[model samples]
Target: MFATAARNFVEEVDHGGWLIPVSSLNDTVNLLSVVVKRKRFWIWQRPKYLPTDFHLNDILTGDTPIQPVSIETDFIKYDGTYGENMKGSVNANVFDHSSFNVEGKDSSKLQSSFGSLKKEELDVQKLLRDSKNRLLDMSHGLVQQTMEKHRQVFGIVKERIVTTQPCSVIEEVQQGGNCGGRLSFCGGKSPKVSLKENGSLRKDSDVTMEIPIHTTIAYALIELEIKHDGRFELCLLSDTKGGFEVDGPASNQLLGASRAPMSPSESSHLKEELEQLGEHFQVLSALPATTRASLLQHITKVMENKEAVSSLQQVLEQMCQGKRPVLEEVTATESHKKSIQAVLDLLEQCGQTESAQANQSTAVLAALHLITSAIDEMTHECYAVFWMCCSFTGLQTLKKLVHCVSENGELPLSSSGLATPTEDVYEKTEHLFASCQVSLKRDGDTVKTEIHQQPGHRPLVLCIAIKGLASLDQSD
Candidate 1:
């Protein structure tokens, strides 16, 4: 009955769901004690038939609690790129309490017990061999799936290249006009045929195609550039009326037209008109101030009066009643040049004094404006003289003007920063003649500058030749 009771108690306590009985003994009856454990493998064993203090310190003192060290078990699989081990490693210590019986304290030898547990030491050699075979099979399947994904993307890129080349070929045929009225293959299609593959095309012939007559790579780049920056759009020519007509989802139309050259007859007529204008300007410049003002007023009045004969000649005739009816030829002599210089000097001297005074006096602003305008007129006459001299001598007279106006005040163009005598004016007009080609018309000794000229117009020898002439005239 005692054996039965002890066995039943041990069995009930050792039920793994809730408890565990680590160790036990039952022979004495004078002093009795029972110990039981709970789940998580915690042990609580006691000596039966003994006093409480007889073995109290042995069961409870000195390292009574032990914590298990951790271990990892990984069921890793391998791929073709690199193989990994299906690894399981133990790094733990065992808990024991045997020293409580003899030394009156709890003690453990977990490290040595864990090291000595070698049931699978021989079995690991066979495990290594088995892992390699399993990894190889996994690697082959992984590699096959990766290669299939690459093939699918490559197919898409190839299709785009094939579809795009034909658009260029169509443009080439239209521009060259060498298709012999037969459409050459644009990505393998007849040039005369246009097609829209968009879902909008309900019927086969409903496709729209237009060839670019003057195709340029710049036009293609413009279309591609906006795609990266913002929302991209296109419009069909048949749908939209004007500027935005050609922009659409997949429409191609060339954007710019080539410039047409002016014909010989049109060129001759323009030259004649320019020459007449030049003559009128020279007459106006040479006229006395009051006489010029009167002529302008008369012309304005005639227009206001709505006169039937309001031509410039008729207007001039009405203004010059008692004065010399026609202009008399005055040869451009040394005396003429000196007289012109003297008048220009008087005008500039007054102008510089007024310009200096303008900053100080708000009341003198209108007078300053009038003086500045006269200075501009004198400057224009100086340019006319310089250009006329060049025409007569066949020498480039503008070199001195360019040199004086240059930042360095030197003949040779240089990158070095240098100061000029007239720095303010020089900075503004230094590059004026570097781009323009001028042509002069010589009628007797008077040379007139014309805008329209023959193809033989000299390549930009120099444009404005008398830049520093105003400053010189002022000094004189």
Candidate 2:
């Protein structure tokens, strides 16, 4: 019989989809078959109770022990016959989760030299810094695109397009794919047909089919909720997120100014529209290439034509919605831990406006300032997230070194691997921990050791990497 082994079945939250794809599901089943060969015990479905961001690919490497999450992913022992090997496989860590201690784990290490090394608190802080920059860039990009769309909408100003005030009701594309209530006539015009010499329709008169009928919309509104302290959230008003409410007076005004009244729908001959269409056309020869778009928050509200953006009232009824997705957390690496205080500080600082503007109900100007100054005061305090306790390699090294020194009492300098390849490396970071020579001197109670860099005969990255790893690791 084969082992009842299966990689964790993580929930698919990286994308917004109704369900996981068939291809991905099939691949998972195939992979399970390959891993669990004969299958001693049975697992109903893949285990889905793991961490949201727990990626199995991050761990798998040759000869790495298959330690299961004791009660969670642990397979039941068929009998004591499978023996100690199978029993050891089910145990999670060198330090088990239930108890804070491990059987043969030691807790003593010299006080770590925490001078400048502590300031370089791992890659996560760097990742967070990059995220902050990306968000600000998105805001700037969205603003530019919205302004361009605003310019095009303004082009038809002279045609008396403001026929009615906007209803402010949420709507979508209608049955005929017409974007209801949208004022920009910039995309997909009415379909045209080609005619032949005898004034008859051409056989392939669908030449104008490619002309898009969908209205090209832009991101017009953003709701940035700046909560008490530094709890802040920013949402773009888009069709996918169902848009934000336009209830606040100032925010509501911003929404209304960005729209204009739509012409009432009528059933009339094509020639009937030709006369007024020409008049409207003459007015729009150039708003596309002129002035900078000012705040569109004061579009004239006309009441005479009182037919607000049609009676479409469309709603996407996704009553049985998919499960809510989770945000990926910035987890700590083995070398360093995150300071909760730093995250709180970011929430308080980056999540809020600087000063007086924070008190104002509609302080868009102040919120803009927060984006720049959010990561200003970064605390350089971090601890071991994977808890700097005894690891398998550490324990093995301690035992081996003790045994070596017990006889010789000292070794000048030698390769640490004991005439072998690096079998004890963390599979995820095997490449990062390059070759090194370690010298141990047994003086008093402690065996003083120094790890010296050894550039073996290999390609320098396919040349340079220890430098990169030093940059990556928070520990000096």
Q: TM-score of each candidate? A: 0.14, 0.14
Which candidate number maximizes lDDT? 1
Q: Tell how far residue 389 is off in model 1, in angstroms.
A: 22
Residue 363 error, candidate 1, Å: 36
Residue-wise C-alpha lDDT for candidate 1, range 1-476, written one tens digit per residue? 11222222233323212111111122111111111111110011111111122111122223332121222222111111111111111232223211111111111110100011100011223322322222111123322332233111000000000011112111000000011111122444544443322121111111122312211110000011011112222121212211111346533432211112232123343344333323323333433454334433332222111111112222223223323322223222232233333332433343365333432222122222222222222222232233334323222234333333222223332322322324333322322332232333323322233333332211111221132221121211
What's the CA error at residue 223 for candidate 1, in Å?
Answer: 24
Worst 10 residues of 2 by lDDT: 308-317
The total of clashing pairs for model 2 equals 7
Candidate 1 ranges with C-alpha deviation above 4 Å: 1-277, 291-421, 434-476
**Candidate 2 C-alpha lDDT tens digits along 295-374:** 00000010000110000000000101222212122221111112222222322332254442342312211221221111
Candidate 2 lands at a TM-score of 0.14
Structure candidate 2, residue pairs in collision:
188-212, 230-347, 230-348, 337-383, 460-463, 460-464, 461-464
